[model samples]
Target chain A: MQAEPEGFDRVLSSMCTEPHPVAREAAERFLATNPGDPGTYPTVAELEDRAITMLGDIAGLDDPSGYVASGGTEANIQAVRIARERARTDGIESPTVVVPESGHFSFRKAADLLDVELILAPTDETHRVELDAVRERVDDATALVVGVAGSTEYGRVDPLGELGEIAHEAGALLHVDAAWGGFVLPFTDHEWTFAQAPVDTMTIDPHKMGQAAIPAGGLLVRDEALLDELAVDTPYLETTSQATLTGTRSGAGVASAVAAMDELWPGGYAAQYDRSQANADWLATRLADLGYDVVDPTLPLVAADVPTPTFEALRDEGWRISRTGTGELRVVCMPHVSRSMLESFVEDLAAVSGRTPTAVPTDD
Target chain B: MQAEPEGFDRVLSSMCTEPHPVAREAAERFLATNPGDPGTYPTVAELEDRAITMLGDIAGLDDPSGYVASGGTEANIQAVRIARERARTDGIESPTVVVPESGHFSFRKAADLLDVELILAPTDETHRVELDAVRERVDDATALVVGVAGSTEYGRVDPLGELGEIAHEAGALLHVDAAWGGFVLPFTDHEWTFAQAPVDTMTIDPHKMGQAAIPAGGLLVRDEALLDELAVDTPYLETTSQATLTGTRSGAGVASAVAAMDELWPGGYAAQYDRSQANADWLATRLADLGYDVVDPTLPLVAADVPTPTFEALRDEGWRISRTGTGELRVVCMPHVSRSMLESFVEDLAAVSGRTPTAVPTDD
Candidate 1:
């Protein structure tokens, strides 16, 4: 097949919002120069193998057999679907899905889509899943229990090791929704690890921490046999070896993911993680010293407990802070964030919180 | 936000398999040169208006309103979901969906996912939905009746005019799945016009004939109220103004789709339709003259009835023909299909079909 346009044209594609440049360049290069034998329209099975192998390496899992999906939501939906299907196979009619309150909203959405009953397990004081609360919710009717790695709010890792023990004891499949933290956790907070957990399935999105591109999500299964329940074989596009909700996927995305995986593994991840964490720590210290309450003092992500009117004051100081619901501010110190930018942001935060300057009319 | 990379790097990104070059370039150019603005993220309402305006111009629906989806399957699923929701609104508890066997399998998958009972409406001798059978299947419990425009099998369109009457008389919603043929039919043979039919909803994929890249599927409804039933609002993502299965979409795809519509609309489709028809006709004639059975002799897509042995023999001749079931051959004269290539394929077909060449001696 003719190669898709690269560079500016590649970025403009409506197929995906913002594909990673390096990944896209790799795809274009592959197109310009055939990587393997020409004439074959690479089989879905081969792509699946490459993705599984690459994602497995990233997640610290061995042979993570799974399917590719459009995004985290789709992956979560499919994982839930499989969880329900597996329940049915094990002779349960109506299955309940136990999820933490702080878990990804995708679990609830997936439950809604699957028509399964949702049981929200209470979170601990730290805004992470409480192991005992989750244990109390599991029953013979429970299909799956979802655990969070790094939650969107508070940015604290859940006690998966404790939760996994509870889920396994109850005979329910434990699904780790690591969509946000899956790509970064391996390299962050050395104490945070999944070496002891019996995680049946997990979701990983490269679009977030891996920072490969948009529209990259994976549902990884520890054992291969679990896929048989969700396996769909179609004449046109079979899921015999593919991981997707839809057929006829853009090979360009797949190629980019592979390249992104190559760039992110090992040394690159450790360095990037440390940088983001350092930036987060620096911001937290500065914000706290300015008399603002920094939520989750230990976590890399910090939220400023500020009055609603404070947003205007901050805006005047040229600070681009995000609102974390009512009376709070949220700031993300991603890998791309530099120390100078953090210092500037901190300075602006202080100026905004310290005194009111000359009024600048708000756009609204 | 910084414009994502394009070219070889982009293609390797996880966002998409292929990004439209021109559209990608245009979007990147716009982003690079323009200042940041909130208008960059179009609201759901704005998207609905744009879709309605575009569909009204192309499909000739006076009050066309639509919601975007990632792919054709999602559009079909949403359409089915809405149809069922509408049925419930009309006081039908258990809604039944009647679909032709030739329709895309997404309907069946959606039916399974939505928990709606599926009734396979028997088709006529031509594999089109039999109107009488569909009429018989409709009852007070019937939710929707589906019709396919340009089925993947033979590129044959169902008689939507007749089916529309049956659905209307039975008080069931009529949905036309025009995902494949919507962009082509307006410019193809007007004799098989289903454009004037009473379709409550229709799906069209820009990535196909519109050539806007991938993952651009839309569900256009004559009555916008139907979409309201599927509308969901979340605090994180603003999906209020438009309805979609997703929250954070690749805005890049939307831009490209808009660009593609502008580029391929009006007289552009005329050329594509003409070329495809000519190629189909030419190939069909050549296949029949060479003593091969072709499905839907009058259609643009030819499915050659060749034995497996014959197919494998022809495959050795460098023809990458797709096979359905045991021995059915499907040939599509897509937009990029060149005339000389088709002629060359025909010549090679004649040589391959003349006689099964003896197997050459090999070391194996």
Candidate 2:
């Protein structure tokens, strides 16, 4: 009964990425295919193959083993599953994973699902993992050390190279949770890919940053054996072996990610990233000028210190915003977040903050 | 660069269900929506709410708590997670899940991911879980008992009401894997839902029988607290609690499922189900008359005893037939499997079985 949904044109606190025009069509094109049963749909299977390769190249890997999953949670779960399987092979019982508090809640779900002990380490004031704290948590039972790139709260990139070295020295796997940063970091000087460290696995959400449709997360591993560790023989399927967390994944997601990469590779995404960063920077500057404390965004996210009442007030006034770990108003300037929208938001923020409303001349 | 994809006009041997026309359009309309992160898109979240309600009602649930997930694997995983959590709360350190050999592979994935022991119960000749074997497997450590509503190989439904009694008596939860049967069982006389048993949870795939687009599976729990038991606090987002296996789920999936239910709820689906049964009966009768051994189909599915060479030959001829566990040729007569397709398939099968091809007068 509902009509076509318009994109989130007015959403500013949106890590919920929108599909690019071409990627949206790509999703429609392959909606009927399931890559999990590849034999029935060779075209979609080949598209998935191409998409994974393009993502590996973007992740700075020569050759990587991976699959297009539902989202970051599935990928993160798979990454930790591989780590636990490998750890078990080396006679490690009661596997534990140490993740910073800034890590995505998917890690918590994974720990709960995988029956592993989750050691949540404390973060610094900036919400970056304290390496010393992580070090204290790592032990012989530690199977994985999770580092976040583009921490959801502040858009802070963790020291992955340092964590990788620490994990390797402790005979543990280093997994970079870069679901929100993978597509943009390639355009920046930041190196969160395999080239920067001996990272065992990484969770990259094409849905989040590649501007693909929902359910296009990738789990890229350094070795194919990492994936094989989860592979189980399926006597019924023509594929003979199953490795993914899902049995019947939407091939449309894989096709859309491929189209997204084809349309917005490193260069195209660089331009888009520039636009997002500029918008974020502009919003931060305006908020700072309004006397509200703001964390300078690392990517396209900004967290402004605002009281709970003011935050609730802005939302009540129809401004879409979330809060940070410290209850600060958070805004993610995605491509959908326009300058006019940001300006209007600041006007509302000024009103809620009880500061002299930054008087932008009203058109009315 | 790919153009609009054609629907499965030529696909047969496809157990993979196609979305209803209306639901397909619904998915396209809400392609940009993300119900998981609902701050940006509230309409899609509302659609998800309605879809879960309709699904619960269809499953004979009074008030069910659930989420639209990627597929049956994710739903099955979450169901197992809830069972494990409840078991752990009851002081069972190591949990075990008893599933019949006929259970879908997702149970295997769930067991592997959740660090639980999977005890495979033996099935009778008809592929129904033997209650005696299940009894042998259920202990204090048994957290869950899995009963398949529709076996993947055969269209056989297990005795869920009986299993439910055993599970409840043993202080274990009963979970029905109705990924393929949720939409059909209600239309039939099968008592596989809550109406028949004290079923704690069920995995139903809207993508499969509901005829929604890909990646619309749901895990419906008996109570809200059962869902809350798995929900962890995600402080950054406006929604404080998170329970799904995915974070940023495909809003399109939720939309499509809602649309599917809206378009085909009960009365409308009965007509479709009737057509499917007729088609299946036609195929089974023709095969039986042709001296081919066939299992009596319970739903819109047929399994015929065919040799390995015949199976390969059928695939070589572009007939999309699969094999049952007993090495029988399997065909799920979905909406796309037309009468002409079945007649052509039977003709080929006759030739493959070294019998004279059925003679039919050509239109010409």
Candidate 3:
């Protein structure tokens, strides 16, 4: 474990964005703090309140109901739990949820754990959910209509405003899975939050684009009062009276996420995304010149159709990357994936593609 | 966030055990490692396997299938989910889970989240679940029978061997939640694991009596092949094809638990617990001499029949403690609860109880 982390150095891991060094310091700062048991440690509770309020402001809610979950998986599962509890209170039976085929895998896990029927809404060529297709799936039994803010495959945000309108029209609650886009799109012109749509719940991860320490995923809901309905009381634990999905959790993640937000929010994060965007644009252009059909990136993530041989070669060269089931290579331009690392990756990619990659202009 | 932790200065927190400083070092070692997306991290995955195997051995498991959950809440929910999945596959509908009244609150949470009917089996005078009451609760619809090895209210082991036999006779799975008891019971002559009972699933927390860093609870099962039935595929993640409830998690908890185990496994932990037991016996005898009826401790946990005035007085003196709903003052004698601290606490209790405590003989 003390081998100096050769695993993550300059690795273009499509599944993750590199966590910043600030996240580590914050995690260490609260290594002894367990925020989950607020009764025992009140200081962590204050930090949790501050973190929630700050995230709520960005998500367009003055006061919000939420929990700092382990990750998107727990957040997504909790969102469904909230929706199901809401539906049950309204006398709905056998409630169902509709999610896009491009949605994160947690929806399926939630569907399985919650005993709810999950129907897939179709996606178009860009991998965005077809708004009309989703509308057709929302019947009287639909408790939630989920729209993916950024698909894991292509980082394409669905038409959340249209989806929200359709869900409201059908009397179904809308939840946005913005696990990847939440941190970045808040800085961009992308309309992906409560300001642009009437979202009942949303999944946001500080571990992803916010570059916070691990396990800092959040589930933010509209109203603060509805939380009483979500709690399952465990008389023994100081944490059981709350609506958290876990019992005793570290304040390390919450502290790190709040610390990252303090550093990144308002204006500092925009510059980080700008650098990632520049890297993605340069990489996409270079790959396109080599005859790869790359989906134009919306964030730092880019997906390109690559030959299986070339995809395998990238792995052999110690460049951490991922591929779709169809062998399309994906690159997440994290801060670690620098210009020099990209140049080295393309050199090996070119050898397998049987073509040379033309260099792109870098003015900045 | 850096408020100099007045919350945990040798305070005997009933809900927590102090994490060793070595645990903090372990967390720092992998602060940058996020093994949730395992494809990017080949090293952490291997370490996770090693840690799981080592924990499984201590739990008397030859080979186990499990996840390093956030804590007991997630692990208990997952165990119930696994039972429900197995029951549904066997054509049982509306699965029912029977738990002892002394069971942890996570069972009630799992019942709510997973849509299972949770039936509370009655406990006896000592707060141990009656074997007959538990036996009568199981039926054809039963998916799981939960037995707490050591109840948080009263640290008493239920007859797990008998409970397991009944569950097996009913063709139901038994999940033992040994979150607090797993670490210490192994050193004691307590029959709490696979060696004593046929448990399908078990919950253990390294952060609890194990004294690792925060959020290191695990759920271990008897068989390895059952994991395939539990996983939801995330095509983009390195761990996409595996079974995990959370998507993005820090590797800090895993590294710390492994490090803690390295420090405390076969013989090292025995010496630590012996000191705690000696401290508990001396304190309990001292309290009983003050005319306070104290429950004999089993695993460094003691419950005393303290008046409201004394309980409030102790709290006013800045000691962190918890009380049973019935007003029994509880003290979990963790490694941090030194002999001097217990001596001082008993002195305060004697003052509040209007009696003088007699000195106890201390012998190795």
Candidate 4:
């Protein structure tokens, strides 16, 4: 067999990280099982229920109705499908969804697939969706209004509560894409959950920051009835109706999600958020000290204004980094990222930029 | 953690089977890597390319253009999306798709999500799709015509060459769903691939008869240009455009597919299919001798007319089996199935029906 690929030790730009030990074990155990046929694989189905319950607790919903999606893209697409169906029932001929320009590209795919008009609302100075712009785009024909809890390019949380109000006033539903922020926002004071706002649906992925295996993306709905729009009558298998986008999904992701949440929920996730946030802050301070423009570390993601040549040099030096749409260097401080790794990155950055290292007092 | 779910010991009705040992090892090695961002994870991305090449060789396409989908559902959905986009370019505002009544439920989900009209064509007495019904239902607005290579209900193959001709006559694309039959059909005389007909797209799942891990579904297109309709601009990622439905897909499925195909291609799959076909024939003869109506054992799947009470008793006795839409007991002889297992099932079936077993010569 071919040698295993390089580990995630130097991957600082991706939202995904290495799976938790328990999550890996769980995934291996259930790798061959299919959770799509719930009646045939009852154990994994029950595990999926437990995963949803735990996710509901974190998202501030007493009762949650959702499934483990293939990823955040599937969850986001399903949310749009529900909104479109609801609007069709209310006599809307051509449905439209208002999403921030800072939203992930999955919304664009959803708009194209579902044949809904996509209206991109501008963002404010903080990189959050502009409230005036969102209000202007949403009208009576709007089916859904999307808000990003922690955006991909810039880790800025949108005003979810006010976005919900604007959507509801226009007879539309609110969907918050918190795929990257759901695991960390519980440690902060962000009103981005079902309890704080009238969020009809939310996308929270376990594989991103929850340290679960890949494909464990969550799609939570405030009411179970919302899933009825996506249901299709399954003739042959055990289940009568299936709501998920993909049939024959593996039980590995469902089991891994349950295992990861059981191992680290409120306490472990809180500590991880603190460490990752501190690392982002440290990197931002170092970059600013070097006379580079840096975005505020609202979450655990940092963006800095490094020259194109310097960014290319850093990448050529075996650092798995990426850049934002506006050509700023972007790095996501996932759980696998450590303080020493960031220090080494700074040394490389200093060398690539041809600048002397700043002398600072060491706490240790 | 909770005990692992029951193994696939008595699972005789599911399309999925236990993963090959090599596939399991490959899945474990690539569990945390995301193939969605191919620039960061080049190893798994190259493995995905290898998988597509092998799939193309098996599907009779020299140059296949597709990706590793989450499962057959996503592949089927993408096929419909491609056809719909092509039809729209031809000035068709409201597109429709014609599928056999025996088609998988995923097509229903696709039609609903893509906002297309779904017209179900009647099936013939042999459980194959009636070409006349498909021709009568198709119109200028029809975007695609779907055919089943190995149907989920009765393990029947539709006349793919004729279906393609009828679809082409109506200016519609032909999509063959060979998800369950792709692996075994190479050993048979079935004309269900790109070389046999004018098939525009095909869905073949590695997790099914290919003995790979779950979520290793293949979507093959004859021409690369068909994928252009699904592309979306990915800004932050290194790749400029992505055509996949999911954003962050796991590399486990991609690596497992390559490993499984490399280990077991024509020779190994042919031997296994021979053994499975013999087992299915043996079971079908035993049930027929017991005075029950039985469908022909086509493609290693047997459907028999067992009484409802007997079927319930078999389930109560822990035999993992399912039924068809017409209520015939269905048994799919997967790679894990053995002759002794079928003999045990027959003994239980005889007991449940209050019948004495006939003495037959055993080929030990």
Candidate 5:
């Protein structure tokens, strides 16, 4: 049977990409181990710690307290659970979380699961959370104020520092969903990490842009004590308690996260960000020249107002693309997305739209 | 860096075992694909459906509706979420789940996360859930009644048929957590599957006894309508809604599950179960001859009332064993466990207990 597509060739608009060779090897070597039972698999457990330390370094935390989660959804859910539990301890009934309208949909899942009221504060024209709206939503029952760092739709980073201040003022914690942006945001001037804000929790996925294998999502808390809210007593195991959402999880993600971070931390990731950002800019310029409305390429993500017919035609031509909620064609410039691929996609777009292709200047 | 403990040697307590060779290769091949976005990765998505179909066959559900979950914890959590949502629709505000005392700890995590009350029913002398206790605890508030098929502690299968009747009478759904038993129980004379019982949902892990890679837990429902309760709108993706708990999950698990199931279904799993059961029986006899109180080998799991000092001493001797909640030493005879390995473990037990080793007749 045809197991896989031809090596992520026509894949775009996906946060995941091809795993690094080191990460693939690491995942294979540790595939059989279970980090859930740390006592049984001490090797992978150590790797998970190292992966967290590297994530801490990237997210600007001195000491990180978290585990490698299934993905951004699990990480985000755990963050909300922590906030809700803390609020319950404070005798707050019907705890609520104020989140940006541009936040990931996992927040809605968390709200439904944890019985928290989700207050969606509108985002500004730039797609960042409106600080005033967040301030207005905070109340005694508010447990958390969430900010999106590298949002899924527009790749916008909210003003996390200001959001943290507002949340703390209202006696609520701040959580940043940096699932997609955490890897590249360090090279930029975005103040979205623990060092930059009073961020109680953060969801940064290694599988997204960290070049680790799939399922390497990171959830870092400012203090280890914050994890106590999510801990459940684990019986018949060596560990006393488990804070993760899933039990008997694979060690592949942990080992791969460590391997990928070790192979491509500051220098390699910086170079990748530069190339990807340049590709996004190139694609955005090409689309704009074609008279299409485009969102600014904030973090290697381009959303253009391509017509539905043109979009469908391009898709029929074998270009894997998706449309946002607002009907704008979205394209994420992941690591596998090269200049040639973008050029081909633009050519296909021009062909489908019956527009002349523009000669965009290329750095490479 | 010592990546792995020398190939599952001395590891006698964990439910996870080494992945089948075909499963490892399949996982590596689909390491980067995300089954979460089925529209983007159709190849792996098809494999996921095939995996579910195979899981349905094993679980005795002819037309199963389910997804490959991260692990048993996620599957169990999703099942609870479904029950809670359905109960909410039925106007039950404070939903409770009646789980056996021998149930996996994930139920507690599910209770804390899903805002559902957890009611732990006592177990009988054979380690199975007490039917009378379950009947007494289940009321209008009970949304779900959980039965353990191959429990974590003693590998005891609860009376799922009777539990289903009780749950249905109370207007509750019955969920079977067969995460470690689904593969082997198909070969046993246990009335624990969907065909045998009125099981509304089931948690069966391919990573456990299925010999697939980790993070390959299966969640199967009796009907497709049950998944609607867990559905959440997913924007900017090929699919409009997502029922899975985590987003952007790895396709490795799905591919590996299909590969493993295809490689070892009826005949292979039957042979393995026979061998593992024989091994458990052999170990139980050896321990009983040494004057140790042993729980019968109900399902390839042996629990002996070894003294705390002896258990600690055996652990110090590098035997990776664990104690159940009642302080009995527990050993699971997984697929990786062999006759020689059990013999060696018995030898170590005798050495630590200062007793003469008894020669047990071996089938091999």
Candidate 6:
């Protein structure tokens, strides 16, 4: 296998093909220096407990138990599996899940993977699921109802409190797919919040809004017994002495998550969320002034309904936004984004709209 | 939520409580450096192809293919799901899987997850599955005959060739649980021989022998049609044109695997197998000569059947090793392990056996 060089050379050759050498080198050095048994590395058997405590603190759930998974998809699948088993235990025939039309597609995938029937609640003009529709869809056979804390298209927060109330009334579990908002919601200045929900479980992606490396999403259960129903262990790998859909988690990813949580606490997200919201509001205002129909003008995510030609024109003018199939463009503002990036996007937008001529992007 | 700074003074604070400032800086730098469609920043589409190509390369198959999963456990579940459908298609009354007793326990877990009957077949004294027993277990109700390449405890390679042939002769599919040996066998200097019978599927773990960062494993299928039988997709995240499961994969993990493959192919693992095998062989001979009953003296992995007193004695001599329930010590020789480590292990064994230590561990 050693053509003419050594193992180190082979490693270097692989590194060359990586997207970012500096980042890859940094990642490699980080791995080499911090190689420790994650089970005991970050403090022994308390790894899972630590994750649980962190989720509780973030979601404002006084008592919660977290199960780390590879990503949001697996976490969603595990949540569905637990819900299905709960329905079976409750003597429900043909368990059904009530999910919003705007909910992550993982909802349907989870239902399919677990062989449970999925019932998608219809959305309103703004793409928010209709609370009345969700209430009407729930029945005695309902296993679980999903509420998206942050919809992918517009980053719109759903009516979790209303949905949770409806699902709980039907004797069904209310699960929140908060993969993008868990790290941000705690810092929101709103009042009637997610903390008021009769929610039973939630999914959070540390790799997304939390800004950690990949493979570090989790499913947090308000009722730990629910997770117990899905617990599985094998002889090759030690899982939560109960049940788990996946086994052999990467310790490196676990460490990164722990590291991400430690960094996110203590008002870290307050500043990031505030800046992001401000930028999004500004972008929405600017785009609307340019005659685009903006959704939820005050939100930190701007979705503008524009024709394909307008979108291509903006792209030609150097904007990197995406166009949804329904003639909407989504612009996300993360912490890494700067005011200058927004200004540049706006300048390009203005030019595309024929309202300005060759306005240069500002640095500030 | 920002609290009073700790003793580490916001340095470890940034790393522990918040996301890595370093990775954020890298993402920022990457955004500034490549300021277009952060979509290229590892999009769902790119991840889909990368996963399919990566899994295909591992199983030696082609595309319209597999999906990225959490690990071998998830992969096994997908494989079993497909096999079950295949049985259903053939109208089997009760689909049964014939698995070697020495196979990874995940196979059993997969069967249990899918509600399929499992027939455990005994292996020979060397821990290889007995072909005659496997042949006897296959019937019209058989879905898959599972084989192991290298077992966890004894590191014995099953006669995959004979087992594959028997499964095919019985009109059953052969699934090779080569999670451990997949990366090893393809690169080892040992004879390149396997029974020429068609292998329907295989599971390989890049996290282990492939030396990629964890949470990278795959299920490969020879006939891509099997994936279609189990294929389920969602709009939130795309899989291959056909897939077994669908969701947004950990893009960074998929990127890391691509990097790992680039490091492993064409000669990456070629020399590693040579060094590891040499070390294992040397350790086996030394242990056997010192009056220890080494399991599979001819294989690259050496498991020594020792008394409790012998184990305690070795532990006292400052040797750290794995132990099976049956008082057997197991050692895995991998690429990073130096030969001197093996020599030192041998010397420790000799001393524990009341013999003089001839070799000392090299400090390298």
DockQ of each: 0.21, 0.60, 0.60, 0.76, 0.72, 0.20
| lDDT for predicted candidate 6 compared with the true structure | 0.61
Q: What ranking emerges by lDDT with the best candidate at the front?
A: 4, 5, 2, 3, 1, 6
> Tens-digit lDDT track for model 5 on A8-66?
77788789999888888888888888889987787888889888899999998998989
Q: Can you write out model 2's per-residue Cα lDDT over B1-364, one digit (the tens) per residue?
A: 6644435644555556677888889888888787887766788888888888998999999877888888888888888888999999999999999999988777888888888999999999877889999999999899999998887888778888889888988788999889888888888888887867788899988998789999898888888888987888787778888888788788778888998899889887787788888988998899777766788888988888767877788788776566765678788888777888888888887776665424441211
Q: Write the per-residue lDDT of candidate 4 for residues B229-329, one digit (tens) a residue.
A: 89999987988999999999978999999999999998989999999999989998998887778899788999988877788889999988888888889
Candidate 2 at B335: error in angstroms? 1.7
Query: What is the lDDT, from 0 to 100, of the residue A226 in candidate 2?
Result: 89
Model 4 C-alpha lDDT per residue in residues A1-364, reported as the tens digit of each score: 5758778778888899999999999999999988899767878988999999999999999989999999999999999999999999999989999999999999999999999999999998899999999988999999999999999998889999999999999999999999999999999998998999899999999999999998799999999999998999987786789999999997899999999999999898999999999999999999887777899999999998888888888889888888999999999999999999999999998877876545331211
lDDT per residue (tens digit) for residues B283-341 in model 5: 99988887787999889999988888888888897878888998899999999999999
- lDDT, model 2, position A268: 81
Off by over 4 Å in 5: A357-364, B1-6, B357-364
Comparing only chain B with the true structure, the TM-scores of all models are 0.83, 0.94, 0.94, 0.97, 0.96, 0.77
TM-scores for all candidates?
Answer: 0.85, 0.95, 0.95, 0.97, 0.97, 0.79
Which stretch of 10 consecutive residues in model 2 chain B shows the poorest summed lDDT? B355-364
Error at A361, model 3, angstroms: 22
Best candidate according to DockQ: 4
Name the TM-score of candidate 6: 0.79
Real contacts retained, model 3: 0.63
Candidate 2 wrongly placed segments (more than 4 Å): A3-7, A357-364, B3-7, B357-364
> fnat, candidate 5?
0.76
DockQ of 6: 0.20
